[model samples]
Target: MTQQNKIRICVAGATGWAASALCKAIIKTPDIELVAAISRSNAGKNLSEVLSLDTEKNIPIFATVEEALQVPSDVFFEYTSPVIAKHHILSALRAQRQVIVGTSGLTDEDYASIEAAAHDSGRGVLAVGNFAISVVLLNRFAEMAARYMPHWEIIDYASDKKVDSPSGSTLELVSRLAKVGQPITTIPIQDTKGYPETRGAAINHTQVHSVRLPGYIVSLEAIFGMESEKLILRHEAGSSAEPYVNGALLAIRKVQLVKGFRRGLDSVMD
Candidate 1:
């Protein structure tokens, strides 16, 4: 693309915590044009007003993704709530646009449909749980450790306000860990407080413990306990969403260069 014809980008869930942060970061990059912003609550408002950005940051906000599509865009960043994120992704795909999704809680059925749509549209779709660079590294390390340990589990942490348990992060972690080995059975049960369900859910045959509290942004740990010393590998998201911005932006800018559905933020990370 020439300097005059930079990539046109649309952001779904414009007013969200992450989307707002991404928009602020997008302002700094000249490689992309913020053509559309979607937020049901802030519909019809200027993007700046919706995100509480300065007047210098001029961008339009729309109520629906379809409305944003009225304009031309090369990529769409889908940050809508998890319940609706897949729908937004599918819609964007049907429009033959690449999508970078940060939302979680997608059902397996939605993934199947998304994979098919990506194949049919010949466009790229990238999704990840936590987009921070460190989280990507954590996943990478976990994958390596799995090759050696072969027996371990996952623990996902979030603020009490966070609703999803066994978060998308855990799913991503477990799925990627499966590339080496996601233990094919629940983590051994030693102490149960009269309720085995408190141990959280199981995915890919690995135990995933979800902890919700008011102390953190988001975090995940890969625990491998063998003979004596236990290995605890973790990635903690600090108090800001800035870390996710770069990863999402990189995926968005590269979406046009890829085809089919790609999973994980690590694809763009070292």
Candidate 2:
């Protein structure tokens, strides 16, 4: 496609790990154009200088989403922190820009607000916690397993730098699983021993255990306790951010066809 026909993208958090990989991916993609790069810390610096792209061309970095949206784009990618993701996404939606959110700190209520904004503006938003296709399938299978085995717990592992406790993927998984059916409603919560905190946080009737430590990039496991056998569904990620690149690109492309809010990359997948 020609330059004018390419999908214009404005990336928030352009200097972060996932955004860094996404910027590189967009640089090589023929049908996408990097119109605006939003990074408060790297504001006024050239994208080539910050990301070290081979091209001598410089992409302007804006300090805020409001400033970045001034450039006009087809799609907005939210790769910023949880604190600012809702604001950035709402701004983009109110401006009638389709958005793909890669941020993980948002709650279900936050998404509900985003969905309402998108509905009012008649734009689209795709949000995913872990973008790898394997992770998506893992969440899908966990939902299926939740139906037959109603006694499952989710364990999410990530590096120390990860702010969210359960992680976005775990939250999504638990939310989906709860929809299949309430987990063993007959089991009484009062029967638990010791401190209640020992059992981990209860989300949508499922327990979610989070482990944050150094050396680990990211990992998620769904453990189902049964009478004679147990079923375990797990997904692990390496140090590099490459796993999320393809999924992010897919969301960017798919956002064009969708209206309102769609959660997970699996929603758009055939």
Compared with the true structure, all predictions reach lDDT values of 0.80, 0.88
Tens digit of lDDT per residue, candidate 2, span 164-265? 787888888887887797666345666776676877888888878899999988899999877888899999999889999999888888889989889889
TM-score of each: 0.91, 0.96
Task: Kindly report which residue pairs in candidate 1 clash with one another.
Answer: 160-213
Candidate 2 residues lying further than 4 Å off, grouped into runs, are 185-187
lDDT per residue as tens, model 1, 122-185: 8888878777888888888888777777678788888999877767778788878767755734
Instruction: Candidate 2: give the clashing pairs.
Output: none
Candidate 2, poorest ten consecutive residues by summed lDDT: 182-191
lDDT for predicted candidate 2 compared with the true structure: 0.88
Whose lDDT is greatest here? 2
